[model samples]
Target: MSLSTVQQVLARIYTDSKLRDDFLTNPDVVGISFGLNCQEIQQLSKLSRQQVDLFARSLKRKRLGEIRKLLPLTNQALGKEFNPLFFQYSETYLPTGNKKHLLDAIAFTKFLLQQLTTDNTQPVSVLDVLRYEAVRLKMFEGKRLLFCNRFYYHLETLINSLHSDSPLIPYPQPNIGIWFRLPNSQWRSLFIPFSVKRKKIFSFHRLVQKYLAIQ
Candidate 1:
């Protein structure tokens, strides 16, 4: 039998939370509205909402796990604030990129930043941490990032404060920042004072060495 119609209905099931709930409560009626014919309705109505919810929750947890692996500092800095934002983000945005988790993590950070600003949020260090990490993650993937050369000190305090449960103390002056992963798979942030041209080249060389070593 042709499965395309059922497949489309199932796609909606996964993407629409409200539809999922309605379908869970009354698949017989709900399936009718989703292009499901009598046979399709009969087959889909047999689906167990309990099992579906369990699987959905598992998928959510797994996605969060992937984000945590990529953005450890941002995850920790937000504490409980991370969950709701992540949930909304995952439900609303479907990422399309080759570097799936990395791209998703970066997109999630941007999503949170947009929401916070939209809500007229108070000064949140967590947002700062996320902005920092998102850029750093790009650098970690070998992308070159240039900044105003003034946000240096602020970046230092932000990176240092990621694991702390307090807001970042903004530095007195405007600052600049550059960050890359170390050989140990640990993040290392460097400012212009210490991140000279030679140091920057050396740091990138180390990135290649680590990649080669891993291979």
Candidate 2:
């Protein structure tokens, strides 16, 4: 009876729903596949299915909570679709590493983008919003000073619509959205039109100062 192997199987059974179901259905077979002997299999088989399911649900809720904190705007925008989509994502993927939450967020953002791309049911603005949030996550994780990405719709208008539950009628106002961290470690985000060229001698410091003054 390898304690480490049994622990590994238990971890998967707790986190992976399909494996949990299979184990509950045929514990001996599943245990054998995991290199568990007869005694270990019998011991694991004694675990109550209802209790295992409750623990798994709790784990999923924790993961969902972390994702909501990391991507509040995206979660708010998705509304009813968020939970189901995350459930689908969790079925196939389990993030690992020191920055597992961050990794999970980045992977989920890409998954959402792929899902929306294939379905074509969601507004195009949603795709941009997901990308914007993903960039923010990466920026904060890396402590990057600046990150920029192109957005097809007016970001401010889209964000406002999401907040208000108004119709998402964002026009095709393309621009570069910029996210920067201040010296005090506060983050700020804004957009600039593509028309703003380097040759125009725009003062970023002045812009930041003015934005701070207004705030």
Candidate 3:
């Protein structure tokens, strides 16, 4: 995906006021960069090569939400500004990176599953469960890196739609659906050289560059 394409897709996504607002309020939908190899991407996302192949083959003809299980995820962290624009860019530009796409789909599916299976539903608060799970999963260790308020809101909308009078499909949950990256010593050690705030900023851009480079 070219820089222009990334910019265009992001522009298209954020051009809608609702999506933009949703993006700002939700963090789990946030996209982060990953430089993982093919095997690693597959393993992290818990998808077989053939499944990814099938997903890629169907992407062109299927609705974006339909291919929900094939988005890739970043085990790394992202800054305050990052959100669904990462997804918008991937879907628009790197649609063939089925592993990355699967990660997003899995995260989304997990969220939907949580909504349907949570202990409480009177108020229909999937966001609460999502926040708790995200914390339990250590999506953000010291502070939030990805996973934002906008991500939760949009996810709530998706789950509600799936459970509406005219349903889309039954909820799904895979115990190993969530994706995470193994840390590299070189990358980890590099952070020690920077001040706290600088390290956070550095980590954000370096990760974003990984995705941008592929584009």
Candidate 4:
């Protein structure tokens, strides 16, 4: 079999529990079904179950780790419900194509939005925060900011929506940018709104670009 086929089979084994269970129970049959020849099947069957299980578990752990980093507030807001929700959400919506964690977050945000629409339930503000961060992370497209100078010029309008009397805004909507990239190259997030001068928004952005030597 081709290397791509092997990768696909291994990937399925890692992601699909039912298929992994079947493979663990009898690798020979699963391997044959995956188009592996007798030698390949035998070699695969020789691999112990524990190794396969560990690999599968590691993938889940890594995914959750990424989710925790990308959606820290959302994870904390859900509390004990986060893990179970991730279990159900991940099974139903297996992310593909992009290995970037931000892409996974974008997918999760979509899932949350759809779930809310389908259930017609109260909106969760954490999802809004997650969407905002995801967009911020996806800001650059081919070395140019996606929104360019537009967002810097419109901080007031964006902040206004967060504080609107309408129920559309997330509860406990913060008045400040909740997440910021610190100088040490770490993600620093604050739940409380911090004071920001609208006039400084554009100037500060320019100053950061010039002094920090990064964007």
Which candidate should be chosen as best, given TM-score against the real structure?
2
Q: How many Å off is the CA of 29 in candidate 2?
A: 2.3
TM-score of each prediction: 0.63, 0.76, 0.22, 0.57
Alpha-carbon runs more than 4 Å astray in model 2? 1-5, 143-148, 161-169, 178-215
Model 1, position 120: C-alpha lDDT score = 64
Give per-residue CA lDDT, model 3, range 1-215, as digits (tens): 34555444344333333443443444224222223334433333443435534544354335344332222111111112123433343343332244544444445445444543463532223333344344333442323334322122223333455435333222332111112234531112111122323332334446445535655
Looking at candidate 1, what is the lDDT of residue 104? 83
Of candidate 2, the 10-residue stretch with the lowest lDDT total is: 194-203
Off by over 4 Å in 4: 92-99, 116-123, 137-215
Model 2, residue 67: distance off in Å is 0.8
RMSD of each: 7.7, 4.7, 20.4, 9.3
Candidate no. 4 TM-score: 0.57
lDDT of 2 by residue, 89-193 (tens): 987778778898998998899899899889997887888778888998888677678776777888878878877877665767777666788566877877766
Q: Which ranking of candidates, highest TM-score first?
A: 2, 1, 4, 3
Q: Give the Å error, residue 29, model 1.
A: 7.7
Candidate number with the higher TM-score (2 or 4): 2
Residue pair clashes in candidate 1: 150-174, 150-175, 150-176, 151-175, 151-176, 152-175, 152-176
In model 2, the clashing pairs are none
Better of 2 and 3 by lDDT: 2
Q: Tens digit of lDDT per residue, candidate 4, span 1-215?
A: 88788888888888788888899898888998888998777777776778988887888878888888777655654557667666666665456675556667667766765775577553445445445655555542122222222121123333355445332333342343333454446543322232334333334454445435533
Residue clash pairs of candidate 4? none
